[model samples]
Target chain A: MTLALTLDNASVLIFALTGALAASRAQLDVVGFIFFAALTAVGGGTLRDLLLDRDPVFWIADATPLAIATGAAVLVFFTAHLVESRLKWLIWLDAAALAIAVAAGVSVARSMEVGTGVVLVMGVATGTFGGLMRDVVANEVPLVLKQGELYVTAAVAGAGAALIASLLADGTIWTTVACIATTFGLRAGSLLFGWRLPVYKPRPPRA
Target chain B: MTLALTLDNASVLIFALTGALAASRAQLDVVGFIFFAALTAVGGGTLRDLLLDRDPVFWIADATPLAIATGAAVLVFFTAHLVESRLKWLIWLDAAALAIAVAAGVSVARSMEVGTGVVLVMGVATGTFGGLMRDVVANEVPLVLKQGELYVTAAVAGAGAALIASLLADGTIWTTVACIATTFGLRAGSLLFGWRLPVYKPRPPRA
Candidate 1:
């Protein structure tokens, strides 16, 4: 439980930073920054909890995550302009957050003792939906949907790895480590080595 | 409860139609149309239920709404090309849905015996957030957030009217009627007579 809480907080802070950076790029006001930050930080987990019928939601149950996100937004609001490459920073931080969040999702779902399919779906949803919401609100083409992007694929792979690890190992820590390493490794490879999946190409209509 | 269920179903069908129209404009596939339709139909109420800590969200409790949305999506996917002005149809249908949805939200919140402020927030959220999700997913600027549009304003007015009517009258029917009339009337006025709120304009920075 402590590990899950720590992972959730870390991901919330990192995702909030990315959201605030996006707000700065959009030239939104301070309120907009806070709104985006909080939304991005909590969006994925909120969806998970709602679908799983977890009452009160994470942020509502404990306000610390909300406070952390708000603080991150304020911090970024003042210092974003000082960053040399906000986009680069945003991308890397988002990748890191995604890995941590997926692990957190797996941890939560495992604790709940749901089936493997739901656990995997929750992991991917938690890792990707926050960034998806952020991009949609900011009016950017969602990175998850970008042609042949490895974002969702990476999340799925990581979650699968965690499940596999759980079958072979006995501890939550090993599963979590497996999940984060696989997610971040694939995402980082895509960024640095130009790793990609084949994009769909339209074929000519039938004659 | 039956009245609330009827209103919820009505709004879900109308919102799903609008979502399908959006998918048509985006030139997405049949699956995409269904996805958009279901998301828009459930997005707002899901958010409200999560916030209110309602167990097993409405659609999960009753799958009829999901089936209705899917049926609407398939219908629109085949017939949307025949509509000469999809955008016009979408706007009017959305307004009707918004009014019905607000009434439903108010009814549900009131039944739960929540405070007035929460009731008002839920009403607006249930009215506007569905279309907001539709627009965001379609990558179109959200009609609710469009410059000076009376969309959210209309919802607020409608919710306020419901509360005021409750104070003055004795029945749920009266409050629901007041809410719908005020919301649709304001929205129709905005469409027909150019009703709008003042929008924010950036001023030059200090010289």
Candidate 2:
């Protein structure tokens, strides 16, 4: 498989695991596990593809990623009992998935020769949308919208790094490496240290 | 505007109103009102357009619908206090929006010469996805996924009707009319009669 395809499938697998872990925490049935897992694995990329007008979608054209997502979801469903502190594992898995997703998204956009703005946006969307969808379906506030997390910022930095590297480098491998490293590094830093962005504080309503 | 555009705009307006009302109930600020409203109004159509590979999403290409949605949200934000029982109004508005959205979705797919199955899926997605997004953002279980609602089924029936009509008739007017009538009629009937589909009952977990 191509490097991009490999990165995409890896992202899908990890995201699917996170989704299934979420469903397990919510005590959702088997169907819900599968649905949420698949949704989280592909939701971001699906939105990006749609926005870019990529027909047949990446997964529809190559079902391998989807198969991996579904298979991972099922395995998580059966093996969740074996994992201790699933939430902690979920966070780490999600961070890794986010990095891979950002790399894959940036790679696709750069290859398509889309404008810089669109490429950056696609990268972030691909990295974050799936987790947002998973949280929403699980009836939790999306982590991206939560205060004091460097989630989207990390994606933006990673995507920007990818875009810059693509312009300077001869091949895409360097671009992917830069994108993944920036995203995963930022995310890991936030997880280990309490890194945060400035949050909006709502003013008290008038009497 | 053409009939399809009219239907799309109408859907956007009402869905935006419902989204704004939801934000009002959630005690969100003005920014939330606009965000939720725009998300609800265009969410479904955006997904459908993306899946169909239509470039420059309908609202993106023509800013009128987005303008209407944002305008309506702002208007509701200012005047929400004047309305009695916002939830009551929200339900009625959502039903109307669902019908219009279904019609618009079916119309687009039929015009694109897509298959009957795809047309139906797109119609349902267009009708229901906006509300789903709104509810998810509002941290409520999506009304469509809730037990016993005929929400999605209504869209399916309407889209199917449109597809059959499109095959038999010459103009899209007939297809649009059929779609709107079936969807609205079913939704209204459910409201008036408490009509519902069979609910899924989860089994108790083994000890």
Cα RMSD (angstroms) for every candidate in the order listed: 6.9, 7.2
Candidate 1 chain B, poorest ten consecutive residues by summed lDDT = B198-207
Q: What TM-score does chain A reach in every model?
A: 0.95, 0.93
Model 2 chain A: lowest-lDDT 10 consecutive positions: A26-35
lDDT (Cα, 0-100) at B62 in candidate 2: 94
The numbered model that scores best in DockQ is 1
Per-residue CA lDDT of candidate 2, range A1-207, in tens? Answer: 888778788899999999988877766545456656877998888888877777777775666766787798778877776766788888899999999999888877777867889889989999999998888777777878757778899999999999888779948489899999999998888889977776888999999
How far is A69's C-alpha from truth in model 2 (Å)? 6.9
Model 2: chain A TM-score against the true structure? 0.93
Docking class of 1: incorrect
Off by over 4 Å in 2: A9-39, A46-93, A114-122, A136-141, A144-207, B1-43, B50-85, B113-121, B132-207
For model 2, residues B1-207, the per-residue Cα lDDT tens digits are: 777788889999999999999999999999899999999999999988888778779998999988998899999999999988999899889988999999998878667856565667678879989999899779777765544556766777788888788788958478888888998888788788977543333334435
Question: How close is chain A of candidate 1 to the true chain A, as a TM-score?
Answer: 0.95
TM-score for candidate 2, residues paired by index: 0.61
